[model samples]
Each structure stands twice: as C-alpha cells, then as structure tokens.
Target: MANGKSLMTGLLVGGVIGGLATILTAPSSGRDLRTQLKQNKQKLESILIQLKDDSISLKESVVKTAQESAVVLKDVTADLQKSIQTWQEEIEPHKAELQKEISQIEEKIKELEQTLNK
Candidate 1:
C-alpha cells in the first residue's frame, strides 16, 4: 500500500518537474509556451485518470484475494478439529482396555500377597 502511494507521488511530482523544466528551457514565444503548457496539462490529467483506475482495480483484487483466503482458512481449521475428534474417539476403547488390564494385574498382586501371608 505504501509502495503504491509512493509510486503515485513519484509520478505526479516527476510530471510536474519535467513540465516546468521543459517550459523554462524552451525558447518559444509566449503564445507557443502557453499552448505547450495546455497540452502538457491535458496529458498529465489523462495519466492521473489512468492511474486512478488502475489503483481501484488493484484494491478490488486485494479484497477478493483476502476474502478467499479467509474462507480457505476457516475450512482448514474445521477439518483439523474434526480429525482431532475422530482420533480421540478411536483411542477411547484402547484406553479403556488398558485401564481394565491394569485393574486385573493389581487384583492378582493382592491375591498373591494374601497367599504369601497364609
């Protein structure tokens, strides 16, 4: 954005400076100088109009790209969340099985200790 502004400023300032330099350096009659200035002014106006149109088009393109990126980001986030949930669901049965095995091992240890005491 700053680059665009700088480019526009540079073009405007350069055009003005070039026009002044030409007008000052040229050995033209007063009437001819005035005609030349008018022509230069018209050309500058045309350039500015074209630049304005280009800038508007660039802004619209940026907006569209940003909107599309946001939608894609949203979809990706949702998919990641779903994947995580599915992984957790798949692990739940194994987790329960492990817990049950641990409980059985603890009970056998207690029974062995009791028989040792007898």
Candidate 2:
C-alpha cells in the first residue's frame, strides 16, 4: 500500500514537472500562454482533490482496522480471565488432599533423620 502511494506521488510530480517544462519551452502569444496556464491550474486542482479523497479513504481504513483489533483483544482478555477462574475452581476440591500428602512426606523425612542420628 505504501509503495503504491509513493509511486502515485512520484508520477504526479513527474507529470507536473514535465508539463511545466513543455509549457515554458513552447512559443506562443500572451493569450495562448494564459489559456495553457489556466488549464494547468485546473489540472493541479483536480489532482489535489484526488489526493485528498485518497487520504480520507486511507484514514477510514486504518480506523476500521484499529477498531476490529481492539474488539479481538478485548475478547481474548475476557477468555483468558475466564480460563484462570475455571482453573482455580477446579483446584479447590483437591487442596485438602494435597496438604495431607505433603504432611505425610514431612513425617517420613523426620523419621529417617532420627534413625540416622541414632
């Protein structure tokens, strides 16, 4: 997209320069030169209008994309929070069993230490 814009800008600049050089080099009466200059002015104005329209379109597209991304990010965050809540709920039932196993292991370790000391 950026490349297309740059190419369009380069072409417009080249066209303007080429048109101006041709106008300057052409020999003509005052009336004819004024007419050509007027035509060039109209052309430049038309080009400016086109550029403005393109800029507005590009701006709108960017805004739309940003809005969509924001929605997706919001959904993902909600899902992750829900998953965390579910995990905590699932772990709740096993808490007492886990504590009992840890207590048994500690007792075994203490017994082994006392036997070694004796």
Candidate 3:
C-alpha cells in the first residue's frame, strides 16, 4: 500500500512537472495560459471532491462492519457464560452425592476396625 501510494505521488509530481514545462514552452500569450491553468484547477478540485465522497463511504462501511461484529461477539460471550453456569449446576449435585458415599465408606471402615479390636 505504501509502495502504491509512493508510486502515485511520483506520477502526480512528474505529470505536474511535465505540464509546467509544456506551459512555459508554449507559444500562447500569458492570458491564454492563465485561462488553461484556471480550467485545470477546477478539474482538480472536482476530482478532490469525488475522492472525499468515496473516502467517507468507505469509512462508513468499515464502521458498520465493526458494529455488527461487536454485536455478534457480545451474543457469543453471553451464550458461553450461560453454558458454563449450566454445567456447574449440573455437576454440583453429583459432587455432593460422591462426598456422602465417601463418608459412609469411612464409617464402615471405622466400625470394622472397632470390632476387630474387641
């Protein structure tokens, strides 16, 4: 992109130099040259205006795309949070049941040890 911009700048500079050289060497009177320069300036102004409009359109398109992406990201984040919460809820009861079974096993082991000691 930088290369392309530099090339365009070089081309524009070369064209301007060539045009000035031509105008200086022309056989026309000063008044005719001034008129031609005025016309060229108007054309350049019109082109600048068109380029400005195009730049604005491009910026708007970029902004819209970013906004849409942000909305999608927000929705995806919400779904992920909800899924994590649901998984936690589903696992909690099983965890509690396992703890209860472990306690029962420990109690049976203690009872067996007491009987053997008698």
Candidate 4:
C-alpha cells in the first residue's frame, strides 16, 4: 500500500512537471497556448477524479474483507471451544470408571499381601 501511494505521488508530480515543460517550450500563439493549457488542466482534473474514485473503492474493499475475516475468526474460535467442551463431556464417564477400577485393583493387592503375611 505504501508503495502504491508512492508510485501514485511520483506519477502525479511527473505529470505536472512534464506538462509545464511542454507548455513552456511550445512555440504557439498566445491563444493556442492558453487553449492547450486549459486542455491540460482539464485532463489533470479528470485524472485526479479517477484516482480519488479508485482509492475510495480500494478502501471499501479492504474494510469489507477485514470485517469478513473477523467474523470467520470468531466463528472458528467458538466452534473450537464447543468441540473442546463436547470432548471433555464424552470422556468424563470413562475417566471415572477407570479410576474406580484402579482403586479396586489396589485394594485386592493389599488384601493378598496381608493374607501372605499371615
């Protein structure tokens, strides 16, 4: 974007300098010179108008794209959070069952050790 702005500025400055040089060097009558200058002025104004319109369009497009991206990001984040929550819910029963089994095995091991000692 910066490069684009710099290029546009360079083109505008170059156009103005070129126009001035052409007008100064031309060997035309006073009326013809005035007419040429007027035409050049009109052309420059048209260029400016077109540039302004293009810049506005570019700005609108950038803003729209950014808004869309933000929405998509938010949706993805929400989805990820819901997925995590669902996964945790699914695993909870299995986790508790495994813990109960481990405790039962530990009790049996202790009982066997006590019998062996007796």
Candidate 5:
C-alpha cells in the first residue's frame, strides 16, 4: 500500500514537470497555449479522481481481509481453550486415583517399618 502511494506520487510529480516543460517549449500562440493548459488540467483532474477511487477500493479490500482474519483467530482461540478444558477434565479422575494409590502405598510402608521395629 505504501509502495502504491509512493508510485502514484512519483507519477503525479513527473507528469506535472513534463507537462510544464512541454508547454514552455511549445512554439504556439497564447490562445493555443491557454487551451492546451486547460485541457491538461482537466485530464489531470480525471486521473486524480480515478486514482482516488482505486485507493478506496484497495482500502476496502484490506479492511475486509483484516476483519475475516480477526474472526478466524477468535474462533481458533476459543476452540483451543475448549479442547484444553476437556483434556483437563478427562485426566482428573486418573490423577485422583493415582494420588490415592500413592497415599495407600506410603501408609503400608510406614506400617511395615513400625512392625519391623517392634
């Protein structure tokens, strides 16, 4: 987008400089010169209007793409969060059972040690 703007600016400046040089170098009468300048001005105006329309269209496309990307990102984030929550829930029962078994083993080892000491 920035490149497009820079190119457009360069074209506009170059056109103006070239037009002025051409007008100055032309060996025409005053009336013809005035008529040529008027025609050039109108042509420039038309080019500017077309450029403005093109810029507006490019901007709209960029905005629409950004909006679609944002929505997709939001959906992906939500899906990932839900998947993590589901995995946590699925693992919780096994985690609790493993903890219970560990506690029972510890109690048995302690009792065995006490019995051996006695």
Candidate 6:
C-alpha cells in the first residue's frame, strides 16, 4: 500500500515537471504562457483535493466495516453460549433417568447370578 502511494506521488510529480517543461518551450506570448501555467496550477490543486477526500472516505468505510464485523462476532458468540446452556438444561433430567435404569440393570444381573449358583 505504501508502495502504491509512493508510485502515485512520483507519477504526479513527474507529470507536473513535464508539463512545466513543455510550457516553457512553447512559442507562445509571455502573457498566454502565464495564463496557461495558472490554469494548470488550479487543475492540479483540484485533483489533490479530490484525492484527499477519496482517501478519507476509504478510511471511514474500512473502520465502519471493522466495527460491524466485531458486533456480529459478539452476537454469534453469545448465541452459541445460550444454545449450549439450553441443551444442558434439556438433558439433565434424562441423564438422571438413564443412571437409574443402569442401576436397576446391575441389580437384576446380581439376582440372576445368585439363582444360577443355587
């Protein structure tokens, strides 16, 4: 990104230097040359102002996107935690029932083993 900015700056400077050189060599009257140079200066200033406004707009857009992304990420994280909590709540009662069933099965197995021994 820094390299791109430097390249653009170099191009603008080179263009200005070339334009000045061309104007100096042209066989126009002194007054006309001065007028043309003044016009060129105004145009360059306008381009620079527009470039600055564009940069500011781009910066604002990036910041807004980052902020929105952060909000979405936080919302997703909270929803996931809530879903986990709900699952735990729903499963706890069934877990106790399953434990009770296992204990009953173990007792039945012990009774069968004693009868077989007899």
List TM-score per model, in order. 0.70, 0.63, 0.51, 0.65, 0.61, 0.61
Question: What lDDT score belongs to each candidate, Candidate 1 first?
Answer: 0.95, 0.90, 0.86, 0.95, 0.96, 0.91
Residue pairs with clashing backbones, model 5: none
Query: Candidate 5: deviation at residue 84, Å?
Result: 6.8
Assess the local accuracy of residue 101 in candidate 1 as a C-alpha lDDT between 0 and 100.
100
Ranking by TM-score: 1, 4, 2, 5, 6, 3
User: Lowest-scoring 10 consecutive residues by lDDT in candidate 6?
Assistant: 1-10
lDDT of 5 by residue, 31-103 (tens): 9999999999999999999999988998999999999999999999999999999999999999999999999
Candidate 2 runs further than 4 Å off: 1-35
Worst 10 residues of 5 by lDDT: 1-10
Q: Model 4: number of clashes? A: 0
lDDT of 4 by residue, 56-97 (tens): 999999999999999999999999999999999999999999
RMSD of 1: 4.1
Q: How close is candidate 5 to the true structure, as a TM-score?
A: 0.61
Model 2 weakest 10-residue run by lDDT: 3-12
Worst 10 residues of 4 by lDDT: 3-12
Over 4 Å off in model 3, which ranges? 1-15, 79-118
Please give, for residues 1-108, the per-residue lDDT of candidate 6 as tens digits.
Answer: 697599769969887898879787899998988898898889888988888898889989999999999999999999999999999999999999999999999999
Error of 5 at 69 (Å): 0.9
Count of backbone collisions within predicted model 6 = 0
Error of 1 at 71 (Å): 1.8
lDDT of 6 at 100: 99
